[model samples]
Target: MCLLLGVLVGRAVPWMQGWRTRAAHRAAEQKLDALYSQYDDIYHRWDE
Candidate 1:
């Protein structure tokens, strides 16, 4: 299954630390940006 494969990939490589760490940071930043944009849209009115 893909889930198992992903888990194996995530854990099986010691040489993937920098790439994996950057990937995680990029993911977190994207999530944070999405949440902030959502909150901004919810709170601000364009034509009020």
Candidate 2:
């Protein structure tokens, strides 16, 4: 029983880490996109 539990945990830990990494990366990309959009809006308004 202990061995089985250990194996299950070993598999889950890496998967959970990968999921967290992807989530963080996606969040960062969204933030960068929003900043760029804001910059573009300001630039266009200034041009007018």
In model 1, the number of clashes is 0
Local distance difference test values of all predictions, in order: 0.87, 1.00
Candidate closest to the true structure, highest lDDT: 2
The reply for model 1, stretches above 4 Å from the true place, is 1-15
**How would you encode candidate 1's per-residue C-alpha lDDT over 2-47 as one tens digit per residue?**
9999989878786588779989999999999999999888778763
Error of 1 at 8 (Å): 22
lDDT of 2 by residue, 1-48 (tens): 999999999999999999999999999999999999999999999999
Q: TM-score, each model?
A: 0.59, 0.74
Consecutive 10-residue window with the lowest summed lDDT within model 2: 13-22
What is the Cα-based lDDT of residue 43 in candidate 1?
Answer: 77
